[model samples]
Target: MLGRTMYALISLSDLENDFINPYDLTTRLNRFVAVEYGAQFVLTAALLFTGKWFLGVAQLLLTAFLLHSWSVRQHVVDATDVFRQLPLQKKRRLIMFGAFLFCFVMVTYRLIESIIHGLLTDEGRETAKKLFQDAAASLHHY
Candidate 1:
């Protein structure tokens, strides 16, 4: 199942890169998967299990690390350009702004993606609901 989802995502991304609209690719994939598998669950039960939070966090951290590396490379390029032509004070300020923007955009994108996925995906939504209910029940019992 994990392989299937990974393949689907990769294929969709490839198609999009090839100028095919993702919506069309997604719809076609959905229909094909539905007919072939009878059901489609993009996220698995394991993904929603409480024990997998660490895995999810790790994945997020890995993605952030990768993006940070790319951002740092871009900053280096920009800084080289600016330092060559701009005043030292102006270059410092621009570098600071670049760092701030990189962190802000990376964090915001991760947060928004997580929230949107939690809202849009059944596994995430169900897991959240189950967690809330369990907490409430535990409180009542107490």
Candidate 2:
């Protein structure tokens, strides 16, 4: 399950970089900003609901980075130039990427700690139960 979850996350990212951007679907997808922000918020909620608030926060930070990137792209005066980043902007991008690495490390640490300590709060158990029920109910409708 852990391997599958990691694969799904990586695949989603690869969907954009390997396929979406290369095929120039970005313009079609960005027809509405809601498509971008809506996804981030929903995924963040899912992460939080699963007792993974660190991942949720990391998703939010990624959203922030995307917004910053979009702002930089929008400000470009040259029509043909695409997302031309200034040196400082490039540095900031690196910093944000580093932050992502830090968040991933924290997530890994949390998972290991949970496994070693076997500590699940009552609230977390309840949330997990409810989430499982909801997913099961939704699956039945399909």
Model 1 global lDDT (CA atoms, 0 to 1): 0.46
* Candidate 1 ranges beyond 4 A from true positions: 1-86, 121-142
lDDT of 1 by residue, 77-99 (tens): 13224224224323433443444
Q: Please give the TM-score that candidate 2 achieves against the real structure.
A: 0.41
How many angstroms is residue 141 displaced in model 1 relative to the true structure, after the best TM-score fit? 58
lDDT of each: 0.46, 0.54
Cα-based RMSD of candidate 1: 19.6
On a 0 to 100 scale, what is the lDDT of residue 100 in model 2?
57
Checking candidate 2 for backbone clashes, the offending pairs are: none
lDDT of 1 at 19: 50
Clashing pairs in 1: none
CA shift of 109, model 2, Å? 0.4
